[model samples]
Target: MAREVLAGRMGLREAVRVGAYADALADRVGAARHEYERQSPESRAGEEAEARRYLAGLRSEIDAERAPSRR
Candidate 1:
């Protein structure tokens, strides 16, 4: 599909540079994955909090795309 090809190209570039806000959003999600994989918190509460934070970020990005931009 078109998405797969586009994603593949972005991955190849290492950092896709989706402007300022989107770049920060992508970094946050990547950091969350790293935290979970490395078990950085070592507690159920911390892990759950990280998960919630990441989900909230995803929701934010979705909302941003769906709404009109001021810029």
Candidate 2:
């Protein structure tokens, strides 16, 4: 969160707001994970790998964005 603010992706006040909502966000993530786990292996086939790749791409995008601006 602090990194986001330092990277200029989020302001301090927005970070504080996100902090306040963190618990709720965590709960939702947990619920989603639980539901995903409940799915049969056949139904979930290939999804975990796809999700991992998607998340890795997002991380790369964020890292690129956080790099010092050339301009």
Candidate 3:
């Protein structure tokens, strides 16, 4: 995704920044999933739901940024 966003295009600085953001988000999602799995059964259900909601929001943000803008 970051590669697509940066494709053929960015200066070194911009590419680095984009890469950092992608890495951070990936780490966050991984940590969240791991934590969710480690929770008690009752808590796991709520945490899993929250993780899904957060992931959906992340997807929406990515899609919105990638979409072509209106003039």
Instruction: Please report the candidate that would top lDDT against the real structure.
Output: 2
Better of 1 and 3 by TM-score: 3
Candidate 1 stretches with Cα past 4 Å from truth are: 1-42
- Candidate 3 local accuracy as lDDT? 0.78
lDDT of each: 0.70, 0.83, 0.78
Which tens-of-lDDT digit does each residue in 1-71 have in candidate 3?
45645585555556546767668777989998898678899987887799999999999999999999988
RMSD of each: 11.1, 6.8, 8.4
Compose the digit string of candidate 1's lDDT tens values, residues 1-71.
Answer: 23534777555234444465457768889998886677644575776888999999999999989999897
* Residue pairs whose backbone atoms clash in candidate 3: none
Clashing pairs in 2: none
Which ranges in model 3 have alpha carbons more than 4 Å from their true place?
A: 1-38
C-alpha-based local distance difference test score of model 2: 0.83
Tens-digit per-residue lDDT, 1-71, candidate 2:
65778999988777767855566667888999999989999778778778889999999999999999998
TM-score of 2: 0.41
Give residue 40's lDDT in candidate 2 (0 to 100).
91
Best TM-score among the predictions, by candidate number:
3
Per-prediction TM-score to the true structure, in the order listed = 0.39, 0.41, 0.46
Ranking by TM-score: 3, 2, 1
